[model samples]
Target: MTDAVSYPEPLAHPEKRGIELIESSERHGRARDLFPVWAAPNVSVLNFTVGATLILLGMELWQAFLVIIAGSLPWILTGIVATSGPAAGTSGSVITRAIYGIRGNRVVVAFFGWFISAVFLALNWLASSFMGAELLAQIGFTDPVLVPVLVTIIVAAITVLVAVFGHSLILRSYPVVASVLLAIFLLVTAFVLPHVQWGYTAPAPLEGLPLWSAMTIGFAILASSPLSYSNSPDLARYLPTSTKPSHIIAATALGGALPAIFFTSVGALLATGIDSAAMDLGIESALLALLPAWLGPIFVVGVIINTIALNGMTTYTASMAFQSIGVPIRRIPSAVVVGAIGTALTIYLVMSTSLLDAVNLMLQLLVLISGPTMTVFATDVILRRNRYSGDDLFDEQPGSRFWYSGGWHVPGLLAIGLGAAVASLFLTSSVWTGPIAAAMGFLDLSVPVSMVVTAGVYIALTRLAAKRRPTAIPSIEGAPA
Candidate 1:
């Protein structure tokens, strides 16, 4: 009952390959017919889990948390734009298309989005199934390994089901779920905050310059809240007209930023007692340590929702990532693949080992990549242009570009490269924590430093690149399928 979708490839020109240059039609039809009424609920839980979990982990060590916040600020700030905006999109991918331009390459956008989706999907699957298994184990009603594995399987199936049954169900659920998540987080924070030693020097405080171990820890923790930068449009696409665009900042700051302060405060407090294995203990375990065993499990049951809440969004985003590239597996099929691979990795890969090394590599890669991508998106939306009036969002045509230029936007590319390079030097390593390196040599938030480096370098390069010849936005004639 589904039609196979083969995406049209981008042009064969070699220079243009710098961008992915691909467009796709609605290969997979509606995944679900659920109404849009659930948006608030879904967004509520989604933001709470994403925001708190990221801060709880990444900010456990203040300096490390600080480092991550420094580098990731520009992008995370966009959540305000993403959530505060009005409903301008007919489809999620269309937003990406608008920026990519009908004449400009968009496959570049899809490629990065896909990579981000894969990471989110895998992490969320692990977190959710862990929640389900732990809750059951707390009640002594299930076997350990069996329950964990079974729940993972079921979760994966559900993801596939949602993906297959897509549409209003997932989108509408955002606001509703996000509201619940926000409420719970607030309650949890209220309970946990009293325990934190505010301004307490983080254990083994960033030595001299921040330590590599701490920097790495910070880097990993910072990653916990990546969805705001990565998955906003999916949620953004579902924003109601009744909501003013500016309210997004309020929603994001409340739903996203406040949770960070709450989570980090909790993690920091817990670290005071369980400093040695803080990273491994999991935030929920640390809280459980503070309460009675019986209460621990009850609290953990809520924590367990991290995996479910996040993974649901992850699988959903992954399907969109797939569709962006013209992989038209119906909702069910896409969900199945994302869930199976993601959950399987959780049970088999994450359970047996620490993904510390993998996490570092991934964070490093994404930071630089996302920097430019974020710049283009924010720049386009906030500064340069508004809605596309020229071309069908799906059609690849010369609809919008700054100064009406054609071909690749070299300034964006330069900015990303510059940002990543600067960010990397500040990264925790044998030589130094990224910020300390930049700061002891230069002292302040590493993000501001990196932004300066990226912006200056990019501007210089853009001007330089522009001197040779006027380049038009590259023709992604086949961009919108």
Candidate 2:
């Protein structure tokens, strides 16, 4: 009998995996596998809550759906980024060193990677705890204090456990998570769709921002979708080298956008179908009032499961982001650190009087950071035509092409700063309302302003550099020594 070759599980060597380039022999799995595995389960309490706020703010049903579509359109960039994984053979933040140089990438890894992940972990944990507590109460565990504590323990534990195991288990769990959540959401949709006030066109509550501000909020929501692309390569990096770019782009974009739209639309329908007070009670309460009693418990379980799925990914990605920041630790240990920090933040957020206010603030800040970076990175990818030297990517030796001015890509860094400043001028949020936004009647033009300014400056500077030193710009196919 012939001896069989042995292969280890993807997450088997967690410590061995941080930010390193994957060898061709080590890469496996289809690009298409990511569609159901990551996409469907991503629709969680956050998406529903974001959608609910639109209705609560008096956006008409059609308007809400249109905005969701508009916001979701940015998910395409995430899918595009996913295609970079196999060739780059590293996590998203690490891969950006090609554009920004290794030292320069630190700025992005801090803001886009570690910070965004930490904030999201806390946000997801808080939302999950809220839903889990209410679910427990409905099931007769009505001790207010005990329920919240138990929920926190259970949710936090699952997230940490899954993250520590790393990639294989996370991908495997998505199919199950997606199926269960989809079934439950479909049932909720069936219950709510019939009762939706399709013709309701009334203005939102006065406390809500006026029309211009609402539009800004809508764009901010849209920005979050694309911002996710920042770390998408972390998940996509496991695919085989031959995986087609088109396949990765299509799978991720379709997978993520579909469920997001479905759930957000469902929330919109529910928001208009019932009084806003029920929504204020929580997404579960809104569903429980409409869903049959028996279905309510099952749906709540689905909500808990969905929440876990989202947090699990957040914890895993956050760990990768931490590792990308030159942390001298294994992935599992880093994940433990993330879990501890995230848990503490979550506890603080849960005790706060207004979770919605916190969420709005986080989203606003996210747009200001993500919008400029995306413009610069996307432009870099287009300029290079996706051809990159794998060796040069990780090389930080003295003469490495990526070592622009002792590892700092000054132009790229400057563009990010300029973009953030322009974005802040029009930022309208619970965090800090910009003077320009107030003067412009709350126009909220932050995203566009950031994109235009950052792209304009970066492109201009890059072309100028290219003209001055033709040898400085390296093409992906191969570079002259």
Candidate 3:
């Protein structure tokens, strides 16, 4: 396999490579480096918003805490999937070619990978802009119209610049970013804890079926944050193949899950003291109202910085997704394109819709696809025993091992399709409600249901295909015959 062309210092030049394989010569970094890479993004005010939404969804303080912990647990699967990066020395988008075949994988990457990631980029930008605009207003630039537009542009520019700088810069910068955000959030947490009503409950607490339904929806909301990160391999792909898989998994999972749980729990606690009217304005407004005036500007700055860190990874992954989908663009231009699209979406959401409502709907919808997609990825990694050839994965010829059944892997495509279809049946969103969810007293089982169905179907069909035509099975590099 040819080595990826080395570039100059990442800080001085934009990343030139896209989804190309990273050869062993170019691979560097310990598994533990992934901790900050993953953590910096999860240390977000958006996570706090998600936690607050759980309370707004009628979950009690204790129930919201449980949901936060349980929901963030999917970061474990994200960690497992990251193992493929070192094994394959490629982004998650390219690694999936082994599971879905080259052509089939393109379709999956274009829709589930790129489109969803782009939408999230917009959401992150919007969240930061909201906080930023508020900060400007506090400091006397309170033009309702101009402040948002100005903040959105500034935030998008910073985020895209980081993404264009690419992997090395991200690795070098995120630890510092994570440290600053962690300290700020810890301080915020200290102020928040005292205000939490230890025995807080909803105004009119839900009963039996209603309670279960609310909890399920809250779980889906919480789970959506972690599941959106199916691209964990995008960052881990630069780690040496000799890196321990357990270390990779632990670092990535703990890095992401720890902050997510802490920040989200803080949001839930902060919600206990906020009035519904303040919440209606948004989490930023509610949070600022509780914090001392002196800390308000600092919190706002933290939110904006957090958005940049989180969106940097999102944009990087989206650029890789574009390349994985066969876009004839360089990584730098792809980052620009992703940024433009996300900025446009952010402007629209800010001008035309309620941010919280849009966020809730988006998170719920995200679970429908990400759940199954990540499940398939994790399952494939286990079945292959974490062995892959970077060269073979890049091959697109008709006879390449990854080009199954005329460039399609029926088992994988079917697994994801059936899984998403099943998940939709248990979905509860403003967009649509599944009949199964309605029949079961409106319980939303989308997350777990989709994952289980996808894994089961994929295992069954892949085994059947292997038995019928063993040669068609994935080329496991070091497996026992």
Candidate 4:
């Protein structure tokens, strides 16, 4: 047998590979190493914002906790999907060729994957810019217009710098980042917890359909956080094939879910101490008001760092998605492009919209697409038993195994279409409420509806297709179970 390709190790260098298969020789790392990789990004002020938003939605403290746990469970699906990384030896964007066909996969990657990543990149930059601008104002650099503009540029530059350095640098840096963010957040928790009203509830608690609607909305908002990580395999693809699927699942799931749950719960607690009027000012301002003045700068710094950690991971996967979509660009340039576009979006949103309102609407709408897409991906992984041929997956010729039905896997496309269509009818948001949701007292069933329909339809269609054409389903023998 010929020797496997050698690649550079973790160092201060830009990652050279994009959607290309990682050679076995180049795959090195314990599956557990993924914990920090997933965790650090999620140790975010956004989670805190989410928690506060849940309280604002009229959920009692206990109800919010239930929503947080239930909503975050989707990370388990994300973890299951991560196992495909070691099995396929390629990023998630590339692996979808087996499910959607080479040509069809491009459309999904370009729109569903890359577009969502870019939106998230912009959101993270915007959040961090606000915090960075606050830090400047505290230090007497308080020109409202110029401060935000300058801060956004600085935040974008820092985030792009980390992403441009690529995979090895990200893996090496995230553990330290996770450690620092966790420590600082814990300190914030200590300061905020003493003031929490343990038995707090809305003075006029929601009843019946209103309560259910509130719960469903909260669930959709929280679940959207994990569902958006459908591209998680981009980070896990470099692990050795011998790595246990269980370990990868455990590490990735817990790494993300733990910090998310904790920080969100903290937000819930912090919200209990603030009046609705203070909360209307924004979660960041309310949170800072609760902390000692000395900790303000430190808290702002933590928020900026958290944003960098999250956006760095986002931009990395987005660059891979860019290359996967047949973009004739290298990884480094793709990073720059994604960064530039994200920066532009951030600037526009800052100037025109209420950041919190934009965030809420985006999260609600995001679940309509992200839920079905992730469900389809996770379902495909299970059907194949996590077995894929990295070399065969890259074949894009007309008669190649992945080129089913003239470069489209009809079942996958049809499933996603039917799923998203049905889900949209159940969507509930300030911007638009679907017909079904309106009739049902505005209950948001979009998240669960999309996932169930996508999985069920994809499975049924894939089986029927297999009966007609045996080669329609590619099989690889001796793959690790």
For model 3, state the Cα shift of residue 7 in Å: 6.8
Per-residue lDDT tens digits for candidate 2, residues 200-219, read: 77653333457657856776
- Count: clashes, candidate 2: 3
lDDT of 3 by residue, 1-481 (tens): 2236674345888887788877678888899999998888888888778888888888888888888889988999999999999888788999899889999999999888876777788788888778878878877998876788778889999999999888878999999999998998888888888878888979988779988898899889888877778889988988888999999999999999999898888888888888888788887777777789888888878888888888988898888787776777777888898899889888888887666777888989988888989999998888878877777888889988778889999999999999999999999888989999989989999999999999999988888777645654632342321
lDDT of 4 at 246: 89
Using all chains and alpha carbons, the TM-scores for the candidates as numbered come to 0.66, 0.90, 0.96, 0.96
User: What's the CA error at residue 205 for candidate 4, in Å?
Assistant: 0.6
Those runs of model 2 whose alpha carbons end farther than 4 Å from true positions after fitting are 1-16, 139-146, 203-209, 468-481
Q: Per-residue error at 389 for model 4, in Å? A: 0.9
Per residue, candidate 1 scores C-alpha lDDT tens digits across 354-468 of 3333343444445545555555555444432233321244444343333224634555555555666666665543234566555553222333444456556544554454444
Alpha-carbon RMSD of each model: 9.1, 4.0, 2.1, 2.5
Which pairs, if any, clash in model 4?
none
Q: For candidate 4, lDDT tens digit of each residue in 246-275? A: 899999999999999999999888888989
Residue 465 local lDDT, model 3: 72
